[model samples]
Target: MKKLNMISMSLFLLAFLGCRSNDNIEYQANLDNAVRKIHSDLQKELNTDVPSLSVYIVSPKGTYFSTVNGANGDLMTRKTYFRFASNTKNFTSAAILKMMQDGWLNLDDKITAHIPGTSISYVPETSDWNFKYKDQITIRELLQHNAGIYDVTNDDSAYHINGQTYTDYMLENFPDHQFSATDYVKVLSQNNLTYGPPNTVYHYSNTGFSILSEIIARVYSQKSNASKTYGNYMYDHIVGPSSKTPLNIKFPELASDKQLPIPYIKGFIKYADHNEITNQKNASAHIGEGNGIGSMEMLSVYIRSLMKAENVLTASSIQQMRTSKGPATTSNYALGCTYVPGVGYGHNGATEGYLSTMLYDPETDFSVIVVLPFWDLRNMNNFEKCLTTLNVTAMEAKKALEY
Candidate 1:
């Protein structure tokens, strides 16, 4: 429950995998086949609409599947790319956990204790950013999004200022902030937030996670010989090992840098007054540890790895990541992921042009990844239905294991 809850504290994604039973070869094989077919069906539906899809699937036992290429013999893997978005939170939490295990920083340690330049503050009245938390916004709180941190980008929602990417924005602004957690404090001070009594409630705050990232940077990246944990650390710790997906959820360390399979599949709505741009995609860099870019195969691999985690932390940690932090905001949120009925853990990425859902069920040893290059506000529940169907898919795959 602790690890699953930790997942809730991080960013939110929807998907997870259950433990792999090596003895159930037949079951695993059926799931793989179903995965391929699922992608096949998706491709057929999307062919006339989108550019290409590099479909992939992974099992609980390190066994993997990818269908970047369609079985119709026309499409070939298409470079195996998709934006992971907020799923990157899994990696962020894992990195912090690694730091904890390394004995570098305690999860209970006050972030202010280690982060040099960073100072915490919140708004009390209306349009200010002065008050920092009095106390109790511990490492665990930040990881769990209970730190009472609030967003401060784009009038607090602008993650990236300007046409500026994360790099451009950070380089221009964070230069003095470099190698210093105090720098994070300074950046934090720039925002208007308010703190509640510590741990009394669960509020999702990217600011808290960002602070955690800065703290990790201070301890492991700056203080240690490694210099930075970044995306590779996520692969080493969780993504590659826990889930069927192996894409580095943290950094572009594993990224090919080739022409990324454009995440958004631009399309037009017949009725909408404006030309509806669809399939907008951004890399994990967009969300950083909160939300990174990834593909279906990588996500699947990650879930399966959780079912068979050897990377670090106990299986209990993984379980905690899947548990609910409390009640969700009309959405079922576990630690790093969301929840669906019968499906233990899942997450959805809601951005401009992309829509994604990854669902996992431990009881069934089942997982499913669903992505659409389009965002239809009219049928937002489309994915909810898809989530339920995906759980059923997982159950069917589990049944095959019995066969």
Candidate 2:
């Protein structure tokens, strides 16, 4: 996923060029030319076969423009659903922040306080059992990726250093494996290792967010006295609340028989090789890690609503979500959202076959959403470049509209 901050120097340059005003005929012509150029160049430049790309930009005044390009089946429609991947973290974090705003919990609450036994919850003692600082892990630390909790998903590259990754282990050992967030935490807590002691460095951990999902579910369950899954909680409270009528965004359940959500585009394990893999069975594995699925249009609208702080969250909560918990100089990450100094706030997520991003700038009320097949995990540079190009395209249009 392209998680890097996207600062739109193009918008500044366009302004420097003294572009025509938004209502002027020349401005409209410039906008059309810019969009056409962006689309054409992307068609030629993105290094992928059977590419499925969706880009949507919404301006402050509520006007929007969007396009879908690529060869993957069904991806051309706004109704086709795609995996949000780690972008799910933004939903997770928003939900948690909302819960905090509603007085359900505080950011500083210790994880063990809500999910008892988590501090001592370890697996086999021989291979992993050291919870020296486990009790100190807090909700804030986890949100900030400073919890020092061992990440099960992409921990130290030495495969199985702690244990097999959730995806690899389940795919090979038990193809029918169903994920239980609670169970995952129980097992992961056992491998008592920290990237460094808490609050030391920013080590992205899907594992930490998974644990947060479990906490969110547990907290909601306590209040309602009804079963609440993490995915359901986010849809009901976070995404759904922000959605406008007819733009409903829902969490997709893996069909009982393990089929991709109908009307979904084909995603690949390898974009270059087109190594397509079936993923419905694994969709439920980690709701927090990235499983919030929806159509590109629905996602775009829903995210714009989020940025506007509609009915979904309080102003204070939204501000909290956008405030960085890291070092003073860097705006790399806020609570659930990532940030660029003068760009926007959001996150990018990539699972095995999908790549997605959502960014919104409250100042300009501008938002950009990109969902596309992630062809190569090793090609971070290219991915970032592709995303930057899209950002420039979107911002340039926003500039035109702003006039």
Report the number of the highest-lDDT candidate.
2
How do the residues 115-204 of candidate 1 rate in per-residue lDDT, one tens digit apiece?
Answer: 332332211122222336724466766766666665432223444457653344663575322332233344555543444545655667
**Tens-digit lDDT string for candidate 2 (58-148):** 6644444445454553444656777777887887887887778767777887765643323322122322223446567788888888776
lDDT of each: 0.48, 0.64
RMSD of each: 12.4, 9.8
Model 2, TM vs. native: 0.77
lDDT of 1 at 337: 56
Stretches of candidate 2 off by over 4 Å are 1-50, 71-75, 114-132, 156-164, 240-247, 252-262, 271-274, 277-281, 327-331, 377-403
**Model 1 alpha-carbon drift over 4 Å, by segment:** 1-79, 115-131, 153-188, 235-273, 276-291, 324-334, 377-403
Task: Give residue 312's lDDT in candidate 1 (0 to 100).
Answer: 58
Model 2, residue pairs in steric clash: 122-190, 123-190
lDDT of 2 at 64: 47
